[model samples]
Target chain A: MWDYTDKVKELYTNPKNVGKIDDADVVAEVGSIVCGDALKLYLKIDDNDIITDAKFETFGCGSAIASSSALTEMIVGKNVKEVEKITNQDIVKYLGGLPEEKMHCSVMGHEALEKALKQLKGEKVEDHVDEEGEIICHCFGVTDDLIRRVIRENNLKTVEDITNYTKAGGACGSCIPKLEDILEEEAAKPASDKKKEETKKPLTNIRRMQLVEETITNVIRPILQEDRGDIELVDIDGKNVYVALRGSCSNCMVSNVTLKNLVEAKLREYVENDIVVHEIK
Target chain B: MERVVYLDNNATTMVAPEVVDAMLPYLSGKYGNPSSIHSFGGDVGADIAQAREKIARFVGADHDYEIVITGSGTESDNLAILGSIAYYKDKRHIITSRVEHPAVISLCKKLERDGYRITYVPVDAKGNLDLAYLKESVDDDTAIVSIMYANNETGVIFPVEEIGEFLKEKGIPFHVDAVQAAGKIPIDVNKINCRLLTISGHKFHAPKGIGALYVRRGTRLRPVLYGGHQEKGRRPGTENVAGIIGMAKAAELAMEHLANIDEMKRLRDKLEEGLLSAFKNASLNGDKEKRVPNTSNIGFEFIEGEAILLYLDAKGIAASSGSACSSGSLEPSHVLRAMGVPFTSAHGSIRFSLSRYTTEEEIDYTLKTMPEIVNRLLTISPYWDNEKQEGKPINL
Candidate 1:
């Protein structure tokens, strides 16, 4: 579960403006059911273009709901121009903090507020549209050139890593093939001597298995045996491993904890840090 | 250390103490390959036979020889579906419902790629399968009709026995993935007339990485994995002796405690009633009358399921969302989508699956804490704001 701040929880439980204002000067609806979150905002404006009253309805998770709720509370007494200037960062700050993944929830609220202001002024919301002739992955709005740049800079090993860096294919997932094409295109390019300075060392499966077995027998098993437990290496797949518990350790209640902390930690320290150890039954 | 309340038994269960005791010897001093010709091996084989008998008795199968142990419930599912398709290569059609676990769904996708035809039957708003569609989908070319006995997400019980009986008359093989329902509900493979059934050890109080499939004596299947001549070569690999022992012991315990299932059903209903009465716009997902004894899916309007889950977690209560697996990913649950649950309520659906371990105090605490959280999230929802606007026409 994501850790929610007190402020986020408070706003979630007792959201400031939660009803529709009749005869509002501005209204905005953003997101769709497919996106798994939607926000609708209503604004009551005074003669001076001040947002006298603001209310919101959101269909989303706690962060989305709380962020929308908080957004309404922040903008009700502010002028329309000021509301337009509210950023996602500001909304997140107002809620004390939001998990990084949920940052999009705040961005959605900010976008809805801006769209509503545009609707009030009889103007179009034109921020997301691009006129640069630079093709963005239409599915997720990640530019083709940006994907190339990320691949070139990060020296990324897989398409999934590129997703983490650029948020490409993170939404809609239709951009995955295009992203893969870019990765293959980059891999085909010639590399300078300096860029390929280090020689790749491929460890044999037998050697890898030996190292895992030794680590468990020499390090992990002894430590666990102190608690009347022991671990045996079961299977090794690259850096990932499967270990079986023996003796008293096999049926210990805290076996998962031991596997995660002791066995996995020791193997990662001695070998690669990306090892995922599963406890064998 | 702080006390942790484990209400997430539906996800997986803690092994029972007696089951653990039964498994201890195999993991330590009694360790011996069941296939070895030595005296130790004979002893191990005898224990495996005992476990097979216990599991067979638990599910009310006619013979202990019908059980074929495998790696996990997923492996059991794979073996049943894939193995059956392999045996009857002439019959290419497979029928199943939309709310199956990924184990079944992903395997079906793989089979589809391998040129097998698959028809996914739909479900009602309450997550109940359409039996008429199931009957319609099956024909002479249909090799197997695979459906879950009970849904893992909504806990809605499917009419497996009726479907099994229907297909038996037509001479088509019926396979039921009874992983979630095996221990919770009484299952008689002979009565259901199902040629194949799948069960996972971890769903009950058995350890993970061990499960069994009940293949009716005459059913033909090809081995998916090959090495040793274990499980009568139906599932050829070294046996998971300790896990099988634990599973048998767990099944025995489940059978012993079967009479008290009503107590769990009462607790689950009480939890559902409290949540529905306390929270506005709250309703249960799936048919209330046709669900498992210890599961309830409830939707709290205008609140995201993740937030509710986080709140419940913070309060030391463990529950899950129908959308939890797909929470980070934007896909609203396929189960909810298939059931035609409205998107608004589907996103807010929380699954509170109870176990025999769930207590009255825990239910009371959950009921008390839930309404406040729902009201809090709803207040800020833009959907709520939009509903209000729709209620009263706004004049510019």
Candidate 2:
């Protein structure tokens, strides 16, 4: 189960505008039986291209259902042109906020509304396709450039955090390794820049360990400690130092990078030359 | 600790004091391997035989000697399905349902790679097996028909008895994974006439790491795991003495309490009704009539199941979801999918499985807390904007 917000739960428990209108002017549906979610949007369009009434029937999670209901509610008296402009982000922001994984559910609502609007206008809406120029995750239809931009902008440290920004690994989850590759590629640039700053002066191995321990105790421990986690320096050998992580960090998948980038980079910044931090298994 | 409100009975139940007392002597003073040729071993073997007879009597099996003890429910399922398929190597066809537990489903998938043809039967919207389809699919070449007695997700009981009779008439071997239904419902292998049945000890309040498979007399089942001749050459391994004794005692207790099962059913119904009445647009999954007495799958239209479970956990309540596993995968349950449930509502489904131990107070507390939680989550939902659009007053 995705950790839904209070708003998502409300719409799920007592969804509004369910069922269908018999005399609906335009009806639109999206998704398929295999996707595990489907939505049917019914609209009552007036002579002036205004939506007099709107209702929806959704077959999806709370987020999808709520998003559809929210989309219909948002567009019920608005013009067809206005409904076409409503994006998934607008639906999510309207719902207070949705969990990152469920952001796709909101996208479904936006698509359903747009399709309904196109039907009402008697216009041919192009099928949703990843045009040649679009940088999609390929595995899940998320764009690679969008994911990269999110990582660079948010200073995202983990792949899970990148999911919150771009929803790259939420569907099918085949794009996860690719997402990691992007995170690593983006994370390497800053690391090398910091290493360049430390290369100006070289110190001894003992001084490096002391400096790394200080940074961890001051900077890293406080943040991880909030999650009932901690980092410890195990052994310092030549330029390689081993650290044993405890609490939540021990079971966390991304701790390896935390040891490498955050711990090692900070050590290299203030301490000796070519210090490598290794995680104790 | 007031028994700690053991809602995790679905995982395992507390050992009955009587069952513990019955096994004390064998665990300590009478400790001996049942396989030895000495007096000490003979005494332990007698105790084992007595426990097996007690288990056989509870399930109404034809022969007590046919019951073979194994390491767990997974082991029992593996031994029954894989062992049977291997024994009948000439027959390559096997039939099973899509909603079966992983124990049966994964094994069937593995067997499919080994030159076996498998037909995965689909279920109705209420999780009931289509017996008409089953009859049409079964042929002379079909080696086995494996279906679960009841689904662990929705507690929807299958028509195993009917399937058993149909398969028996055709001389095709039938196997029922009765891990969830055993002790909770009445199972008569004689009436069902199934060639094999699997039951997990932990499911019925016995200790974990022990289960049994009922192989009818003269059934050809090759051993999957080979080492010792403990279970009449059918399953080779040392007996789990304590677990088997505990299982026997749990079965005896289940039989004694069979008449009072309606109490649990009533509590489950009360919880379901309360939730439905308190929240609008809420609906139940699976066939209401064919479901187990103590389980209910409810879909709250706009909330995610994980959010509800987390809130419930904070309030000291425990429940499960069929939509996604704990690993955070977004795949809706295969059981719900086979039933043709739409994905929109599938992710919002929460399963509340009750046991005989559930109390009216617990139900009352749940009823009171649920509506409030639902309202809180819905207040900020973009879905609720529909109410505002219709000029309806927002409650929150």
Candidate 3:
């Protein structure tokens, strides 16, 4: 059984705002029965751009029902602009939390809400097809655009994470290498670039040391250790972070390239753009 | 908590009271290494031998020595498939059904990865095995043929006896995974002409952690585990003495209860009939006549199974589903998919397996409560239409 939160259980047991709005302004359906979940959303909007009412009809699991119920509760009596800003994370937070495997339930709610709003704005609403790219995960009919968007929104790294968030590589698993390529491509971009741009500053010596150590431990070590190697944060001086490669990494032929490319690139992405990683050899 | 009407017996049955009582002595005073030379342990070996004899008799095996007890049904399957493949030595091909339980299917998949050719014979729309395909797939390099006696999801019985006869004529090794069928239905290793068969204890009211593999005499089989001389070194680990005793007692009780099979079938048919008649779109998932008497897999169109299960659970009812959401997987049951079950109903499939302990009161309660659950879900189901009393067609 899934480790569902009490709130999720409660909502699933007695979901609110169920059924379709007969005379609603716009209706949108997302997901599919074959995909194991779908939601049809109904909305009644007032002339003042306020949501007079919101309701949903969901066909999925307990979390899916809870998410649809939570979505309707969160959207009713709110302005269209506010409802538009409600991400799947907001619905998850509303219900305390859902099991990671059921995160796609919340994503289904968010997608239905997005589709409803888009339909209300007179935009083309295709149920399964995405405007961004072709389908990638054929088993679940998840498109590349949907996969990439979920990856970016959820900050998903591994194929398992993508499966939990979007159900892209969860079945058959033939698209896992493609999922890995997508992860690598997405990881190349700086995480939260806007925040990085806003927080550009000269750091104190202690803070620089802390950031370098954190980066090495969190990011660099796992990669090196995957290859039966290790790295230790020996010292940090201004923009130059000194690291000691251990085990197989120490005797590696391309240790210099690894230090300059992988370790330095991570330190720069996490600590500072000018941060450099130096081997202690 | 309210009384739980557990219909998920196919997943695991409640340990029989008699079985538990039979095992308590082994857990307490009889806890001795069966391998020891002294009477303290030597007597325990005698009890284990008696248990094996009972189990062998229950499954209609010719000799007690043919039964190699293992950790679980999965281990028996692994030992059977891998052991037979090892015996073949040069043969690198295997034949299995598409609707097999993971114990056999996953092993076949791994063998495929190791450069072994695997033929996953398809099933018909009624969940019947494609026997002609199986016959055509067999060739000189076919190491073994592994197929389940009864599908776990649909309770559909394959033509194992026929397949067994054909393979017997061709001088090929055949393994039947009888985990779901052993106690529910009668199993005769000689009748099926199979070289190996697997049975789990837990499915027949025995405690978990014990299973057995029937290796026919003179079958060239290799041992999967290497260690102490237990089960003639076929499975070398220390015996699960308590579990073996429980299973023996359970099997004896099952033999006694075999006459009551028709009673279990009556309750199953009543539940299946009540549910199908109550819902317009509901239908059975497999061949109704050619299935194990204890199981009924019903599908309610236009709704997902997990949602229906949660509703059933709210009313203190327990059952199993073929929906992907139920298993934390993104695809519906492979058995259902292989049977060509439409997407409209595949996600909504639910299986109710009955045991001898099931009562008419529990079945009636489920029959009464299920309509309310299905109607409630229908109101919140996007494809369900209240006025039309039918599901809306969508491009799934």
Listed for each candidate, the true contacts retained, as a fraction, are: 0.60, 0.12, 0.95
Q: Please give, as one word, the docking class of candidate 1.
A: acceptable
The ten-residue window of minimal lDDT in model 2 chain B covers B387-396
Q: lDDT of model 1 at residue B371?
A: 70
TM-score of each: 0.72, 0.70, 0.89
Instruction: For residues B36-88, write the lDDT of model 3, one tens digit per residue.
Output: 99999999999999999999998899999999999899999999999989988
Off by over 4 Å in 2: A1-141, A146-239, A244-257, A267-276, B1-8, B113-115, B139-141, B325-327, B385-396
Residue B260 lDDT in candidate 3? 82
- TM-scores of chain B alone in all candidate structures, in the order given: 0.95, 0.93, 0.99
* Comparing 1 and 3 on TM-score, the stronger one: 3
A247 Cα displacement, candidate 3 (Å): 39
Highest DockQ model number = 3
Candidate 3: which stretches are off by over 4 Å? Answer: A191-202, A207-281
Query: Which order, best to worst by DockQ?
Result: 3, 1, 2
Best by TM-score: 3
lDDT of each: 0.78, 0.74, 0.89
- Model 1 agreement with the true structure over A237-262: per-residue lDDT tens digits: 78789889988778654455457657
- The complex in candidate 1 yields a DockQ of 0.27
